[model samples]
Target: MADERLIAALDVSTRAEAEKLVTQLGERVGYYKVGMELFYALGGDIVTWLKGERKKVFLDLKLHDIPNTVGNGICSLLRLRPDILNVHTAGGLRMMKAAAEALHSAAAEADIPCPKLIGVTVLTSMDAEDWAGLGHTEPVADSVLRRAKLAQEAGLDGVVASPAETAEIRRACGEDFLIVTPGIRPAGVSHDDQRRVMTPAGAIRSGASQIVVGRAIYAAEDPRAAAEAVLKEMEAV
Candidate 1:
């Protein structure tokens, strides 16, 4: 896309389906997110294809594991050279630090741009009710902010957070920290499974560095037009 702030999610389940969305949207969308659905199915095949097409990739594996294991996993991803990569903040300070160190050193050694490392704070699907079911008493916003701070302290580039928390995250993490908000449902659009939702304009005005839209575009009858409408909404901000 002409605007660098919007990311179109390739949330399909197959390579053929993923490519269809890519071809359909074409040049209007320059950045695409490869989440677990398509990525686990096709592995790096789709990433390579996107690279061939000169589109930026957000490899949303949300890696979380032991410090050494996570570091090694990130090292292994050096080959795809995704534009941005998300790791889980729930992995703790050591794990996040190790992953950041591994990515930075590996990228410097390989002479490539170290993919922007973002922390997954909290899933947008979880609301206060769902969070309580997880057995914690803390408010979701408090936990999300805490994790965002932890991510910053651990040297992550930013976080994948909800738009509802975007402004607070910006205030806490500062202007440079990348805030990639999902759960974006424009007005008159279904929120789907997203519990904390905001419109594209609201997300942008809330200070999101990037917003990810999936069903709103990919699920529409005409994805290109849907994406164009989204861009227009974003541009109006």
Candidate 2:
């Protein structure tokens, strides 16, 4: 199951590319992340198609709003019944709690299992200076830890953080709290737009329950080989 934590991000714009990646890496990856771009273009059909192929989907909408609005949004998303979902921890404890409760309630009423609710601590695009510019004097690691704790307290299943902060988050949030690291770059891969990055082995060693890899795999000359390499690295750790 630990090996299955490598989520290959299908960052393609079209369904053809998405389906091709799924076909190539689906056996190696347990879950495929459907982020905003693909979700916006294809809607729930993407999740449905993935399920048809026996793949668990993580819908990374990162929903954020007032407590009532976010709760309503989660209630709606619950109908799609993804394996996992996420909201921004910056949404505050009340919003997070409300969203969780509403999702659980909706799932119960619909006779469906509730999706594991995760929280997004900070975007992988930002760094320490970015946080400082946002009026946060604390280091990026400190800020991530703080948000992760808040998410756990509000009953979230885990948090999405950079791989660099996985160890600190694990130490602060406990072993059971899932840490999904997104800034994973395989060896020799370009960092792209992500600021905080780590290799697959490094991410797993840092205590990541799952690692979200986008460009590193999708943009590779041989995506299947790239994914397999990442799996081997993770196994080595």
Candidate 3:
């Protein structure tokens, strides 16, 4: 059951550390997120190693740039063959569309599976205050839904959004669109730097397609047991 929808964030900085965590979690976690910290250090080596171990990867580079640059970057990452990839939806419709097109075209040419191209609607670390500072007068929830719709229109598979907005995105984007939520802290755990978070069961109940968890598991004294607890919470829904 842990293998189904839980993604353990391999937040370590070295390939060896990531591999050690994977070995520790073993079959409990099949999906891993290699975000900027680790990806910057190892590049595609981490992804390739995960694939070699037959584990799924979410390459969370959060690409945001000019249309051409974002699209070209997606094309390059496709070679690593991550199961999922994401871009910043704030880059606007054109950039999202370019990433989708580039991902599909390159994967087709290479005869490999194209990673699901997800757009990031809003970050979990930001609450209303941070959002307001960015000059968004509209409600954060409203902005998240609007971005989700834009990502849909741009041909993105789905979005990386907070669990607080998962139900709305699910309602607006339909059941088929992927919604990967990252602000997941197990019950009784500290929220850490993430401001918009939900318990494991609550996220699944809110219609999250998948959940990414980091410190709640990795920082625990026993990571495998922590992962099992999260999985149990997920199945509680």
Clashes of 3: 0
TM-score of the candidate numbered 1?
Answer: 0.98
Instruction: Write down the lDDT of every candidate, Cα atoms only.
Output: 0.94, 0.89, 0.93
By TM-score, the better pick of 2 and 3 is 3
lDDT of 2 by residue, 80-191 (tens): 7788899999999999999889888899999988899999999999988888899988888888889999999999999999988999999988999988899998888888
Q: What is the lDDT of candidate 1?
A: 0.94
In angstroms, the error of model 2 at 67 is 0.8
Candidate 3's TM-score reads: 0.98
Clashes of 2: 0
Off by over 4 Å in 1: none
For model 2, which pairs clash? none
What is candidate 3's lDDT per residue for 1-237, written digit by digit as tens? 346599999998987888888999998899999999999998899999999999999999999999999999999888898999999999999999999998899999999988899999899999999999999999899999999999999999999999999999999899999999999999899998999999999999999999999999888999999999999888778
Write one digit per residue (lDDT tens) for candidate 1, span 27-102: 8999999999988999998999998999999999999999999999998987997999989999999999999999
